[model samples]
Target chain A: MAELTYREALNRALDEEMARDPKVFLMGEEVGEYDGAYKVSKGLLGKYGARRVRDTPISELGFTGLGVGAALAGLRPVVEWMTHNFALLALDQVVNNAAKMRQMSGGQLKVPIVFRGPNGPAEFLAAQHSQALASYWAHVPGLKVVAPATPADAYGLLKSAIRDDNPVVVLESEMMYAWKGEVPEEEFLVPLGKARLAREGRDLSLVTFSKPIKAVMEAAELLRAKGIEADVVDLRSIRPLDEESLYASVRKTGRCVVVDESWPVASVGSHVAWLVSHNCFDLLDAPVELVSGEDVPMPYNHSLELAAQPSADKILGAARRVLYREDI
Target chain B: MAKTAKNGRNTLPPREILFPLLETMQLIRAFEEKSGQMYGLRKIGGFCHLYTGQEAVATGAISVLDLSRDYVLTAYRDHGHALACGMEPAPLMAELFGKLTGSSRGKGGSMHFFSAEKHLLGGNGIVGAQIPIATGVALAQAYEDSGGATLCFFGDGAFHQGALHESFNLAKIWNLPIVYIVENNQWGMGTSWKKVSAQSDFVATAAAYSMKGLVCDGMDVLNVRDVVGEAVEEARKGNPVFVEARTYRYKGHSMSDPQKYRSRDEVDEYRRRDPIVFLRSRMEEAGLIGEEDWEAIVQRTEGLVEEAVRFAETSPEPSLGELYADILA
Candidate 1:
């Protein structure tokens, strides 16, 4: 096994995929000479040259369109949005073209494209930049959405995404780029639509993904200190969600708390709560609790931003609520 | 009767080619006329856009394509483009009927006919949405350097979208093998092109992208064939060309359009210079097609349209299972 950061794992995945397939290519702003806005594509320009690793002129819709077009024309493209925030500019191309091309064309075409960039609330980059937009993407039928919280998963899931035949969205976190983890030394692929069991326990089930999973794990540790053993489910892939695993966990635990980075209404956590409530209706001992970000727009102030997002305290409170610990 | 084209472009294809070209235009006209009638009869549902007056636009452009290698993608007024690209009429009509035998297996209705073997991409519904995609297809063409070119057709109303400009800029910089043809049919739904476009002539604006641009009479079939054929050749040499085909739509934008935007006089003015009539007369005056030949072609197109209507009527609707099938694979 080799240790690496989330950014390195992503770079390794792209480099390996580009080397493996001639039909695969990279396109986005600064993916070449500028070495990516976050340096995730650090040396790809020199390694592959401009022919494969291209630098685009800040044209999200244009390049994203080009990516979808190339995919339709039988080329695999990895379209890097500088961030999910900037991706909104190309939302039409993604939502309308990439998502609908396969079904609308009656399966005559396959959009083997990836729209990858940093996502979710990060630090004090309030308002536009701090929004978590994965649920909106998950709402679409033709897309496969995944977010990896560790270096190993970042490598494995991205490698699978580059090879996937459908349009895939990889919602990486800006906050987790420097976070390091052990990845297999050799090639491996974490298949899409599988959820990993981060921690195994018996008292209650903690459900979450991406950046918020960290706080949920900390909350699990706090619960463990109080002699409350809790199982944690990391939903690596948001869409094609591993309902089988979630149902199995909720069935065993009988109580669940979902921690989400996005707001409450129609959020990813709400859907998970809904599914658990509906499918595991007979198995439930208490109503599933959801700890989601504040509904208001992300605040610019540090303290307010801290309060606006889901944290360990919030997750701990929700877990305690589900665990029937009325008195903290 | 004029032997030379209205554009004065000496593009009189041989009798063999011109005969089929005239026949194809007749086919488009008949098919569209039937589609309009069916829309009225409620045989086809959803937003049904008719390609009534722009027959020559697709006929001319597609006539020059190397069908085995070339690619053509267009906007929602797609029945003409699909037929012109050599799609089977039965499947196209069935698609309009939302039948299982349709080109897109009945999933994509009138606005989204697609045929992979014909190299015809789906007729995109979103305005200017296909521009960037065409540019990307050109990028693939360039990467392969395979001498294949892409023809991206959109309407004048689509020119206002930001993606079109971005596509032009990218195509220019990449030197991608693509040809952008704007079918300037005057109206984008209810709004006229002049009401929205900054430049009086869109072709002249190609200078901003440092690309070659030309304007031609869209009503003239031979002219579109000659110009687009030459542009396709230039594109094979890695040059992207911008073309504006000044055409007209005889019908309203969609079946539901009241068409209060324009007058009957304007429609009649354009109809008097109808492209199909123009092509038939030119072929006859040049001794390329006899009166008997014109009658036979029209009768054949009518027969084809009748067969298509029968096929659409007989084909079965998709089973409850098919609605969920194409969403993944």
Candidate 2:
């Protein structure tokens, strides 16, 4: 095992997959000779040559549809949208073609394509370039959405996504790419739709993923100091949600709190809360609490933007409310 | 004047190529006329776009390619393309009737016909959407060194879309083996070319992308075959080409269209230069077929169209469970 940053882990995954399958190639605005806008595809062009590590023109819809067509023709393509915000230009291809091709073609075609890039709110990036589109993509039935919070999980889940027979959306966090952890050097794949428990406790379960997982974990540590043992579960895959893992955790803890970086309305937090309530209503001692970003569009002011997103303090507050419910 | 064939062989014998084109055009004409009657009777619903005036485009394009290796992807006006690509008329009619025996298993009614065996990728409904998809298909062919080419067909209106330009740039940059044929039928639904396009010349647009451009008289099957043949050959040599086929539609855009945008006189004028009639006259002048032989071909096509109708009428509709059959592999 070796320590690898989240960005390095993604690069390793791409390197390994491209080595194993020639059909697995990378294409994005600056993925090739530019060494990737985020450096996630760094040095890949040197190793795989220009054809496999392609740098596409600034046409998201065209390249995305090209990826879909290549996948249909039996190639596994990793299409990088610089950010999830840019994915809007390619939404027609992602939602209409990539996600629905299998169903539309009556199972005759499988789009083994990955649309991976940084997503969610970033400091001072303003409204256009910052959005958590996991909920939007998760609304579609055919796509598998994943957001890995750790270096190891990032490498493992990306490998799994590349190998998946269906289209997968790997939503990376701009703020977490530098986070480092122990990652295995050998090949490993974390199966999609499985939840990973980062910490175990008996008092309350703090369920979160992507960038918010770090906030929830910090809050869980704070709760431990107050003699409240809080369990932290990271939902690595959003589409084929690991309901069984969630239900088992909620059944043990008897109370749960969801922290999501997306807005409060119609968010992934809402869905998680609904699932916990629907499945473990009898086991729960208190109602499920949701801590999500505020409803307003992400502002440009640093402090205001910080306030708009769910913070560790907010997760701690929600955890306290869920654990100390008087109605229970 | 001497015509130069790329392979240095004499041009294909007149009857050898001409009869197939004539037969395919006759089949398409008969099939569309019968389909129009069926649609009028409410047997087939949804958007039905007939290719009555553009038969030569499909017939000529398909004739010039090797069906076993080449792939064809087109827009909504795709029945003639499908028929010309060797999809049995019966199954195609069944598809339009939303029956199980149809090519797409009845899921994609008119606009989204698909047959993998024939390499007929799709009859995509979205305007200008298939351009990139077809370009991608060509990219894949080049990547795998499959030595195959993809023929992407779209209307002149499709050139107005951003995707077409984007696709053109990518195909040119990569030297993808593709031939983009713009069937300029003068009208996109109801809007004429002059009303929408600021620069009415489609060839100049292709020139912007650095790809070879050609403007051909789409009414003449021989001319279409010659021009498209050159482009397809260039595509096989790993250079993408763009062609603007200047043709017209005798019928309305779709079955429900009232023809309010253009007058009856315009429609009558296009019919006067009908590709089928032009081909028939050329064949008759060359003594390619006697009057009885021509009548026999027409009778055979009528019987085939009636057989297709019978097949569609008797075919069973897909079951409720089948709705879930084709969504995933």
Candidate 3:
């Protein structure tokens, strides 16, 4: 195993996939020569040349739809949006065309395309830019959504997404790009719809995905200090959610607290809370708590922005409430 | 009517080559006439847009394509384009009937017919959504160095969309192998182009991107064929061309359209120059086809449309299990 940053792992995934498949090409604004806005595609331009690592105009709807078209025409395209904030401009293409092409066309076509970029709240970049729209993608039917938190997962899941025969959205985090982790030297694929048991404990289930995994892991340590072990379920894929693992963990712990960076209303966290509440209705010690972002626009102030998002302290509070140990 | 083609050709194509163009146009005409009748009889439901008077635009442009490799896409007024690309009429009718044997297995209705084998990407539902998708398809054609071109069709209504501008810019800068054909049917639904567009000349819109721009009498099959033929060659050389086919749709935008915006006299004027009649007359004047040949062509198309209706009526609705299928890989 070798240590690599999240950005390096994603770059490795892109490099490996493009090298493996001649049909694979990368397209986005500043992806070539500029080496990508986040440098997640560093050195791809030199390695693959302009035809493969293409730099596009600031046209998200056009390029995203073009990527879908390329996929329909038998080319695997990885179209990068500089950020998910800008992806909103191309939502019509993502939601209308990419999400519905397969089923709408009666399975005649497969949109083997990946729309990858940094997502979720980062420091100082407030309101429009600091939004985590994972639920928006997860809500769609034909599309698959994956938010990888670790360097290993960033590598494996991205490779898997590129190889996937359906349109997949890879939700990378700007904040986690510099975070380093050990990844396998040899090729590996962490299959979608599978949850990683980050910490196996029995007191309560702490479920989360994406950047919140770090805070939740830290919260798990805080719980361990209080002589209360918790089961941490990191949902790598959001759309084909690993419900079986979540249910299993919730059933074992008999309590659950979901940590999501997106706002509460109609969000992935709410859906998970509902699933646990409905399916595991009988197997609960206390109500399933949801620790989500504030149901308001992200404030520009650093302190307010941090408060708007779910933190380790917030997660710990939710876990304690779910475990009936709030006094502790 | 020995008309010279716009490609500087002394004469049009040979009788064998020209006969299929008329045949395909007739087939599209017959298919659409039947589809309108079916919609009236309550056999078809939802948004059923008929391609009545604009048959030549689809036939003329599509005839030049090598369908084995080339891609065809269009807006919802797509049955003609689908039929022109050699998609069987029965499945298309079955799609309108929402049957299991439909091209999209009844999932995609009138607005969404697709055939992977024919390289007909889709009859997209949105106004100008196909432009970027078609541009991307051309991106593939260029990346693979395939000697193929993509024909993307949209209406005058799609001109105002930002997708059109963005797609054209990319097509020009990337030098993708795509031909964008605007079927300027004079109206964008109920609203006339005069009321909507700041620039009425659809061909001039291509100049904004520095792309090759061409125009054709969409009512004339030979003119369309010549212009689109030239554009296809230019596209294959990685120069995207935009062609404005000045045509008219005889029917309402959809079955539900009142068409109160235009007078019956205006419809009559365009009808007098019907593409089907124009092509048949050209063929007859050139002594290429006799009255018997025209009769035979009509009979064949009518027979195909009749068989399609029968097949669609007989085909069962999609099974309950199919509802949950095809949403993912």
Candidate 4:
């Protein structure tokens, strides 16, 4: 096993996939000359050359639709959106074309493409740039959404997403890019639709993924220090969600808290909370608490920005409230 | 005035190709006219946009393709293009009927017809959505160093879309092999193209991408054939182009439209230059056509459309289980 950052893990996956398939290419703004806006595609342009590692104009809708079209013509394209906030410009292509082509074409076209970029709030990006928009995409059928919390998951899930026949959206985070974790050297795949148990406890379940998984883990530690054990489940796949794992954890713990970086209303984590309350109604000892970003747009003020978003402190409070302990 | 193209790549059609070209235009018109009638009878549902007066654009443009290898991508007014590309009318009819035997297994009707073997990509419904995709398809051909090129067809109104400009830029820098054909039929549903666009000169839009831009008489099949042929030959050399075919649609945009946008006189003026009529006259002037040939072509087209209707009527509705199928690989 080799220790790597989430960014390096993703870069390795792109490198490995491109090396394996001649038809696979990467295209996006700054992905080539700039080595990716976030440097996740570092060294790829040098290794793959301009033909395979293409830098695009700041035309997201154009390039994204181009990626979908290339997929129809039998090329596997991994498109970088620079950031998910910028991806809204290509929403018509993503939702209308990439997501609909296969079924709409009656099984004639399979768009084996991956749209990856940093998502969720980082620092004080404010308003448009700080939104966690996974739920909007996850709500759509014919698309797979994955958010990895660890370097290993990033490597595995991204490689799998490139190989997937359907369009897959990999939501990454700028904050989590620098976090390091151990990744296996040998070929490995963290299959889509599976959840990883980050930490195990018995009193309560901490359900989350991506950046919020870190908060949930810290909150679990705080709970453990207080002698209130909590189990942490990182939902690797948002669509084709690991329902069995979520049900089993909630059934065993009898208490749950879903932490999402997005706002509370109709958030991806809120879906998990609803699933637990309905499916494990008899198994519950307390109401399932959802720890999510505040409803308001992220503020520019650093402290208020931090307050607007979910934090380890907030997850800890939700865990405590679910466990019938001190709320603050 | 550079009818030969800025790259000097245009080719004049041989007399032998005219008969087949006319047949293609006739087939497209016959198919569309029948579809319009079927739509009026309430047998066909959903939005049905006819390519009535633009027969020459589809027929003339597709003639330049090596259909076995080259690709065709167009917007929703696609029945004409589908027929010209040689897709069986039965499956296309079945698609409109939403039956199991449809081209898209009834999933895509009127708006989305594709044939992998024929290399017809799809009839995209979203305005100007196919522009970027077609550009990407051209990119794939270029990356593989394949001689294959793509023909991207869109309406004049779609020319105003941002994606089209984006495609032009990508096509230029990448040297992607593509021919962008804009069917300037002059109306975007209820609104005129002039009202919708500040600059109605579509072929001029290509200069921004440094691509070869040309305009052809879209109402004349032979004229469309010669110009698009030139564009196709140039694109095969890894050079993309922009072509504006001055065409018009005789039918309303779709079945639901009242077409209160234009006058009957405007429709009649364009009809006088109907591509099929123009080609037939040219063929007569050249003494290459006979009454028997026209009768045979008519018989063949009517019979095929009739059989297609029968096939669609007999084809079963999709099974209840089919809704869950084709969602994944």
Candidate 5:
């Protein structure tokens, strides 16, 4: 079990998937010769050649649409946007075509495509670059939205996403790329819509995904020291949301706190909270508490940005408020 | 320039195919007229754009292709394209009625007709959205070694969309098997072509992508057939071809359109050279069919359309449970 950073795990997944299937390839801005804007696709162009590992002009709409075409034509294309913020330029292809093609074609055409890149708040990137829109994709019906928190999960989920016969959005966090964890060397794929119980407990269930999972785990440990055992659930996939696991954990704990980096109104946290109230209402001991990012746009200042997002302290405070029978 | 129409008889297609083209044109006209009446009675909701004067563009373009192997995709004004591609009139009418028997299982309405078995990708609602998708289908055919070409149909309004340019460049650079047909109708909604575009010539736009472009009189079915036939052959040879079919729409843009932009005389001017009249007159002069035979064909088309409406009226609306279906794998 060697320790690999989240960036390295994603690179290894792409390398292995490409080596396994000739039809599998990578395409995007700076993905080929430039070794990826985040250095996640380094050395791939040298190994795979330009045809298999193509670098494209800085036309997001053009390249993304090309990738969709390539995928429809029998190639499994791994398309990377420089950042999720840049995805707005290609929203027509991603939302209008990629998501709706399979159903619109009456299950005749399968868009086996993957749109991956770093998502969520990156420090000093200001409002344009530093925003979390995972919930925006999760709100759609046909597309699969995934945000894996750990390095191993990043590798496993990406492999699964490439193999999926439907469109999948793999959102990675830019700030979490260097964070390291143990990853197996052999081939493995984690299924979509499955949640992982990162840290099991009984007092309060802390549910989150992507980068916030780490913060939730940290807060869970801090709460454990204060004699409050919190169960930490990492939601790997958000679209085919693992409601079964979420409800089971909520039913067992009788209290829940959802943490998300997106805003509170119409957010993933609100949806999860709604699901809990709708499906697991009888199991609730107190009202479900939610710790979400502030509704305001992300500020450029370091302190302001940090305060805008959900943190371990904020989650811990939310958990205590639920435990203390306070309005949450 | 090289005198490629050597077999003038072949260039003028046999009476057998010509009669079929006439039938298709009449069917489109009658179908759109009936659909217009339906839309007035509060039957079909949402956007109801008609392709009344553009029937020759679809009928002529689809005539030269092998429907079994080739794929066809088009923009929102797609009823003619769908019928020309061999979709049964019943399912199409049912689709407009929001019945489960429709091509899209009643979910797509008129703008999203899809038939996988016949290789009709979709009647996409968004402008210029199918350009890249059709190019992708062509790329897929090339990847699978299927020896098929994809025909992408859009309108003059779609040329303004940036995606069309992107699709044109990539299709040319990759040498994908695709024929990009731009039906240059004079209006996009209420805006006229001359008003919106500085250069109204769409064929020159194709040259910017280093693709061969041909412009044909969309009001003449025979001219459109010959041009599209050559373009389809060129596309099959792994060269993407672009053809601009300069047509007009006799009806309003959609059901809700007031058509306050153009005068009634402009509509009558286009109606004078209607494709149906051109085909029938040519057939009568050539002794291909008698006047009585042409009348019978019109009667048969109207009967078929009436039968389709009856089928659609009897068809069931999709259950609410269907909302959860076809949304995932």
Candidate 6:
């Protein structure tokens, strides 16, 4: 095993996939000459040449739809959105064409494509750029949404997404790109629709994924110091959610708290909380709690921006309430 | 004006060339007319857009394709294009009927018809949505050096969409092998193109991207073939082109349209230049097909459409379990 950054892990996956399949090509704004807007595709243009790693004009809808078309014609295209914020411009193609093509064509056309990019808030980019938009893709049927917390998960999930026959949306975190983690030296795959047991405990369940996993883990540590143990469930994939794992953890702990950086309404976190409360209603010691980003546009001020996100403190508070230790 | 067979790529004898073209157009006409009647009887449902008057655009342009390789895409008014691409009418009719034996297994109705074997990508329901996808298909063709071209069709109603301009720019800059054909039937549902667009000259939009542009008399099938053939040949050589086929739709936009936008006199004027009538007159002037041959062609098309209706009527509805299938591969 070797330690690699999340960005490096993603780049390796792209490189490995492109080398494995000649039909696999990468296209997006600044992915080639600029080495990716976030540098995840560094040196790919040089290795794969211009044909495979193409730099597109700033036409998201056009290029995204083009990727769908190429997939229809039997070419695997990994289209990178410079950022998930910019993906809104291409939502029509993503939702209408890529998501519906296979079923709409009565299973005649298979669109084996991946749409990957950084998602959620980073620094003080303000409201438009600092939104966690996974729920938008996850809400739609016929699309698979994966959010990886570690470098290993990023590498494996991305490779799996590229090989999958349907359209998969890989939601990466801007803040977690530089975080380093151990990845297997040999090839591996972290299959979709599975969750990893990040930490184990019997007292309570802390379910989360993506950048918020770090805060959840920290919150678990603080709870451990207070003599309160928590099971940290990192949900790797969002759409085909690991319901069995969530149920098992919630059933064992009899208490659950879901942490997500996205807004609370109709969100992944809210959905998880609802699922646990509904399925584990008799087993629960208390009502399921949810720790989410403030239900408003992210502010530009640094302190307010940090306050708007789900931090370890906020997660701990939610844990306390769910565990009936709010007074302590 | 359409070039003569001697001057164009069509080296077939006049009778062989002219007869098949007329037959294809007649088949499309018969199929659409029957579909309109079925729609009125409520046999077919959900936004049935007829290609009654604009038959020549799809028939003529798609005629230039090597159906075994070249790809075709269009907006929802796709029955005509499906027939032109050699898809059997039965599955198309079944699709309209939403039956298990339909082209899309009843998942995609009047708005969506797809045949991978025939290289028909699909008939997209959204306005101008197929433009970028068709451009991408052309990109794939260029990347593989396959020497195949893609023909993407959309109505004048879709002319102003940002997706269309974006696709045009990408096709030009990348030198992708594609022909973006705007079937300028003039009305975008109830609103006229004159009200919706500031510039009515669609061919001129191509020059903005410094790409080659061509315009053809969409009312003339032979003329559509000549222009589209020239454009496809250019596209295969790495020069994408934009074509505006000037035509009109005799029917309302869809099954439910009242068509309060235009007058009956306007529809009559375009009807006088009907593509089928124009071709038949030219055929008579050349003595290629006599009156009896025309009658035979009409009978053959009507028979084909009747058989298609029978197939669709007999086909079963999709099973309840099918709803959960094909969401993902």
Once superposed on the true structure, which residue ranges of model 6 sit more than 4 Å away at CA?
B1-13
What is candidate 4's CAPRI-style docking category based on DockQ?
A: high
- Tell me the TM-score of candidate 5's A chain: 0.97
Clashing residue pairs for model 1: none
Q: For residues A12-110, could you state the per-residue lDDT of candidate 2 as single tens digits? A: 999999999999999999999899999999999999998898899999999988888888777899999999999999888888777776665545568
* Per-residue lDDT of candidate 4, residues B1-329 (tens digit): 22333322234355679878888888888888889888888878989999999999989899889986699999999999999999999999999989999999999999999888888988999999999999989988888887999999999868878889988898899998999999999998888888878776777777877899888888887778778988999999988999998889998999899888889999999999888988887777667788998899889988888999999999999998899788777
Worst 10 residues of 6 chain A by lDDT: A319-328
Give per-model TM-scores.
Answer: 0.98, 0.95, 0.98, 0.97, 0.93, 0.98
Q: Model 3: per-residue lDDT, tens digit, B231-278? A: 999899999999999999999999999999999999999999999998
**Model 3 lDDT, residue B168, Cα:** 96
> Mind sharing the TM-score for model 6?
0.98
> Which lDDT tens digits does candidate 5 get at residues B50-118?
999999999998988887779898988989999998888888989899888888888888888787777
| Candidate 2 docking class | medium
Instruction: Report the interface RMSD that candidate 2 achieves against the true structure, in angstroms.
Output: 1.5
The clash count for each model shown is: 0, 4, 0, 0, 1, 0
For model 4, the superposed segments whose C-alpha errors exceed 4 Å read: B1-16
Q: In candidate 3, residue B53 scores what lDDT? A: 97
DockQ each candidate and list the results.
Answer: 0.84, 0.60, 0.87, 0.83, 0.52, 0.90
lDDT of 4 by residue, A215-292 (tens): 788778877888878888999999889999999899889999998989888889888899999999999999999988
Q: What residue runs in model 3 are displaced by over 4 Å at the alpha carbon? A: B1-10
Arranged by DockQ, best first:
6, 3, 1, 4, 2, 5
Q: Model 3 chain B, poorest ten-residue lDDT window?
A: B1-10
Q: Give per-residue lDDT, candidate 6, residue B14.
A: 65
Q: Give the better candidate number (1 or 3) by lDDT.
A: 3
Candidate 4 residue A70 C-alpha distance from true site, Å: 1.1
Q: B88-164 in candidate 1: lDDT tens per residue?
A: 78889999999999998888999998888998886999999999998888888899777789999999989999999
Assign candidate 5 its CAPRI class.
medium
**Per-residue lDDT over A1-328 for candidate 1, one digit per residue giving the tens place of the 0 to 100 score:** 8999999999999999999998989999988988998889999989998999999999998999999999988999999998998999999998999999889888888899999999988887989999988888989999999999899999999999999999999999899999999999999999999999999999899999999988988888888888888899999999889999999999899999988889899999999999999999999999999999999999899999999988989988887678778665
